[model samples]
Target chain A: MTAVAAPTRRRRQRRHISPVVWLFLLVPAAIEVGLVFWPALNSFYLSLTRWNGLGAPEQVGLDNFRELFSDGVFREALGNNVIWAVGFGGLSVAGGLALAVALNKPRRGVGVYRSAIYLPMVFSLAVTGLFWRVQYQPDGTVNTLLGAVGLESLERQWLADPKTALYAVLVAAVWRQVGYVMVLYLAGLKGTDPSLDDASAVDGASAWQRFWYVTWPQLRGVNTVVFAVTVIDSLRTFDIVWAMTQGGPYHSSELLSTYMFQQGFTFLNLGYASAVAVVIFALALLFIITYLVRTLKEEVS
Target chain B: MSAPAVTAPAPPAASPSTSHDRQRVRRRGWAFHAVMVPLTLLWVAPMAFVVLISIRGFDDIAARGTAALPDSFTFEGFRTAFGEGAMGEALWTSVQVTVPAVILSLLLASMAAFALSRYAIPGRRAILLVMLAGNLLPPQILLIPVSRITESLGIYDTLVGLVAIHVGFGLGFYTFVLHGFMRSIPSEVTEAARMDGAGAFAVYARIVMPLCRPSLAALGALATTWIFNDLIWAITVLRTQAKFPVTAALLNLQGGYVSNWNVVAAASIMAAIPTAIVFFAFQRHFVSGLLMGSAK
Candidate 1:
């Protein structure tokens, strides 16, 4: 800890800007600003215009925003995004926390179980999307298994039904996300001060009471991070939804990201898509700003 | 990946335990296994299905359906999938883009990370914030203008365009992780080198770079998986099927062979192999990197 403290003191006193610093920083800064920040800012400006990929830009201030509000598809997309954020984010985090708590202690074959649970996290969402899409077919594995288990009456067209399409996609998203959350929580659990657990155990506290009072409080940092990640991931979702449904069945599963893609590339409504992109950006920015402020404060302290 | 050693050593500081405590611990372990074993099986079942479908003949699948056990298994699907020639080209394209993107991004990010972590730069916190914010923004927001930029720069629909966007997009998260790792290094080592008249470049090259190998390796493994798995950028930037990465190509293959579930399954499984291999090989570092970045 003192090693880090000494560097801060030295950093404050050292005022000279080396030429090496410029050389090292220039290329990454150029790429980041040019490709990322510049384009992100340009998305805002593009939203206010009525330009396709070709032809001169025609300025149409706030028209796209107005159109977006009135657009039923966009509204559906927004509603689905909210549902996705809540459903996928909430379920995955809860599932992950549960898995983490279960696997926290050292036990035989725990590593194998951890690996099996995390295996889905490594696959591309494209593959997972396709895999689940097939499995959700009416005559697919899901229905077949249900029939074999004597639940034939409960089977439905999982992906084809508008009411269940977004939820079906959410199931796949959660499959991948839960593993990520579990890994993070497991690491957090390992780093926790076990003496606190032992002290509470000695105090005649029940197991659940010890965990809720002593353990969960220590995991506030992991919870914030997991929540932020879940929010951002839900907003950034595209590959799986696009690959599976293409936001179809009357745009029932249309997320903001997928909607942005449809408007810009598929429909050539670049301006309208940019507006959708802006909304996505705004939603992500809200959580990102909070996360950054908190993490940076931690860095400082 | 190396399996975590599973020695069940009791905590040294644990007080003398009664028989009741021993029974409780045993019960907890049993409960954990009872819950986790089935969940783990359920989680892996999807991919296992894909692998099974990929190996069976299309006729076998058509006759038996996807859920039933195959009457016979053959590599005919794999042969047809790979012999189509597009898979090979797409895999090459993926390699072409992912390799350069990972290398260039890591090079640039490590340099930036060293400067931010070691020096007394102006507005360092602001710069860090900017990088974090850039990473956190959804890529769809950049899709419109970035594609236009690539077009104007004459790199659109090319591997160069793909690599450039990947590097640019990857810079933030890589730098964030590398900076955190670099900051934890003891500064006295660098101070001594500086006192010995080593220039900043010399200090960075001879000192910081070597120290960053573990983090760099971790980021490299992760970045490769991400760039290879990317579909949105490939769909937005590349115009030709010939230049499509494996993920996009898999989507195309699925479209072209919609009725041929066996071929699509084979192609999808093939597309997934590289990342799976990378993940298993570097599982330890990858998990550590993720935990390091998120857990702070």
Candidate 2:
């Protein structure tokens, strides 16, 4: 049934005797598996003890969890991470959606405007946070601006007040993250069939009506992805908080990441930190799975 | 800011029978521009402060606050940051580790992606899933074994060790992503190249590499951002204080300091500049390719 193949004809298909390929593929994959498995497993082992990471670790199972529940600092850090998730993940998406819509309409200088908005997304979180630390100083620009605008009564210590500190970080966080969300939405918007908008417009639909009814539905999948990623990034954030306040004013701005670092390295409490790492891994995994499932469904459909 | 008049989004492109309708579209376009410009400034306002703060003398930073312009502009903060035993060396340390990590991974990932995308290997899909999972797992979970693994190999405090870790973690996501991009390059082109007796490497280097420029640039920028700003692994694996990356140098600006805000601010802008430069340089390819891949 198949084309009759001569013996020499089959043999003449050049041999793919490439040994280097095996080395290239297997070597990196092996390194990753080894690195990922070892510490992840070690963290679980360490979590069963009371190791300060320096000396002998006492084998005291469940005590760390027990103490963690009672620990005021851990509770505060958890609260702060939740706040960060809402602020960075929730607020930034909303702001990014607003800005993306506003800028999506083509106009003069729109490219410059788009580029400027996305500028903060490229900045290291530490740099952005460091700059904001100066901005939040009692005698800082924020205060000066308030004074200049005759709102001097509202000016106060931004980072020092526990009530206001985490919010201040979120303000800067939103400034950095909104652009990222805008870019994602912009990409989705580009993919959108513009004819649908024109068709709806010809039917006497207002621009707002077309966006709400037509454009928003097309953007559903992208929105799901943005929400999930923003949440993960928010939870894993360490650099910014560490840079500006170091979880200061009595651990007020502390998130799980910064708290884990302080406990593991600074205080040499490795076992506890590993447990916290486990928590972070679980959370990130949950978000990623949701994103993958939704995106995969869209691909299949 | 001048866009060379690309003829991108013009109101005149819209069909208009009446001049009033065209006029209405133009007004909307101008209104949209009005809103976005102010929003963009609010977005970048904080970064503006950091650059300004980096140039001020220590006395001015203290006296006038971060918002106020320097009374006498000077490069004193820059001098302090690059002084002996400061972030200047750390910045170099970051580059030394980052460049090799990025280049080597790009090579390995291209090879792997080529094979996985083009072949009918039974385990290819499963292997890709496993690799993607490895990337999804947080880096904090890998720090302990990475540290001990480097120590056992006797390269824990060296730049080589850091490079190795970056390459290791980078492979999973890099390979997974590059495979998708390689898949997008139509198979007809590679088949034609094969007819010309081009070997695997030639096909990759000549045909595939040129075509996959967007993906490669995106991957390079992604890897650079990751390795440069990474604080956790840098501090964990590099025990010696001086071997610390600039990201870790930010930590040194910590401790119960006797009020060192100016130096901290200066060091921060220095550490952030390389990435910002890269962003500006590859802004188009970096944003479009990456956002397309992820959002798609």
Residue A22, model 1: Cα distance from true site in angstroms: 0.9
lDDT for each residue of candidate 2 in A98-122, tens digit (9 for 90 to 100): 7787778655687888888887777
Q: DockQ for every model, please.
A: 0.61, 0.48
Q: lDDT of model 1 at residue A281?
A: 85
* CAPRI band for model 1: medium
**Residue by residue across B209-296, what tens digits does model 1's lDDT show?**
9999998988888888899999999999999988899999989888888867778888888898999999999998888877767887
Best by lDDT: 1
Candidate 1 clashes between residue pairs 3 or more apart in a chain or in different chains: B1-B280
Q: Give the Å error, residue A242, model 2.
A: 1.0
Which candidate number has the best DockQ? 1
- Among the numbered candidates, top TM-score falls to 1
